[model samples]
Target: MELIGQGMEGAVYDLGDGRVRKIWFDRRPDDVRPLKAFLDELPPLPFRTPRIHEITADADGQAVSEEDLLTGTALQESGVAEEQALDAFVAVVEALRATVAGPASKALPVLNQPFWREDLSWGEALAALVRRRAAESRHHFRRDVPDFDNLLETLTTRLATIEPDRLSVVHGDICQPNLLMDGPRTAAVLDWGFYSTAGDNTFDAALAAGFFDMYGPDAQRLDNLLLDRFERLGHDRQRMYLYRAAYAITTATIYDADAGDGHYVWCVGNLNRLPR
Candidate 1:
């Protein structure tokens, strides 16, 4: 096997055949079974999603799973025209929005783990998540943000105003790396489960547009382009900004508990730049 991809959660390896093995850093077989079950039952969409062939344990008892390798260059690295990339990105979100999740998917875990409550609306749950994450990690960001509390309060207030949404599969992380492209079309969507949930489809739309470009030198301009595209397509621009801010705050300390990583820095910068 050859190491192909790595991230905060796990490492992925090519299994020599037409499959890959993901060695989870902190998950167990049972931990991901629900995700596998849910993906297995998904109705066909315009693009391919993950398929977990099986989950097992390595010698160290860490979860190891084999899955079909849906091959494509990541969308951002595929050299497709910017317009084409943006179109594919928005198309994927729209596809998920149009397709409804069945009852079996209700068991899929959301962004905040066991803290996720079923009764809360999508926006309400996100607001609660902001509170939970802030309680644990605010100290690391307060000095830099100065008005961290005020910003957080405002974010939660805006979150509370989101209208109730239809239940659809929300792919919480739809950034460049997760989107694979063959030519100008989306070949597959990879790496599910960190924030996969059964919730409002608009949440996916908002986050997908923001995640399109978050760190490049032209990031702000590209972000504006995607936001404009979504707005023209009827997505509320303010709500997209609100969701982006909430995502930054809630995930600032997720990959680095002490806010010491580049992603944390990105989150802090995003907070500082929020609509003032």
Candidate 2:
């Protein structure tokens, strides 16, 4: 086996066949079963998506799953022109938006627990989730974002205004790493279940726009460009900003619970800079 990728959730290894294995860092076999079932039932789309073949547990009790190998390089590493890549990114998001959320989509658990409630509206669940995350990492935000409380209040207000939405399949993490490209087209989308939910489709649009290049020198400019594109596609700009802020606050400590990574810095910057 050859190591191919790693993230907070797991490490992926090429099995030297037509398959790859993912050794989950923080999940159980049973925990992944619902996600597998959800993916297995998804309607066909323009590009490929993950398909788990088998699941087991490691000696340490981490879940491990084998999946069909997706063929292509990550979009960021594929040398595709920035313009073309952005178009493909938008295309995939649009495809997902076209898929109306269903029972299976809603039944799959989101990344965080306790905050997610089937009876609650998407906006309410999202607000509760942000509150949960903020409570967990308020110390870091208080230091870096002097207006942490105000920002949280602003986000909560914005979320409450969202009301119930027409549910769509929101990929939740449509970043460069998770998107594989064959030339200018998306070959496959990988790594579901981080923040995956069947909530507002604009949430995916907003997050994907910023996630295109979070750490690059041109990150902010590129983010604005993608946001403009999405706005032109009929997504509301304010709603998008609300979703982006929600993502920043909710995921600030996701990878590093103490909020020490560059993602934390980026999230702080967003918290301070985004209009409240």
User: Which candidate number would show the highest TM-score if scored against the true structure?
Assistant: 2
Candidate 1 lDDT tens digits, 1-276: 999999877999999899999999988888878888988978899888889999999888889999988899998799999889889889988888887877556777665364346587667877887888888888886888878889889899878667555778778888888889989989999877777777667677777876888777988787788888878877777777787788788888887787788888877877887886
After superposition, which runs of candidate 2 have C-alpha atoms over 4 Å from their true positions? Answer: none
lDDT of 1 at 46: 84
**Clash count, one per candidate:** 0, 0
Give each model a TM-score. Answer: 0.91, 0.93
Off by over 4 Å in 1: 103-105
Residues 116-202 of candidate 2 have per-residue lDDT tens digits of: 466788898888888887898889888989778988997887796677458888889999988888888899998887777678888
Q: Which 10 residues in a row give candidate 2 its minimum summed lDDT?
A: 109-118
lDDT of each: 0.81, 0.85
Assess candidate 1 and give its lDDT.
0.81
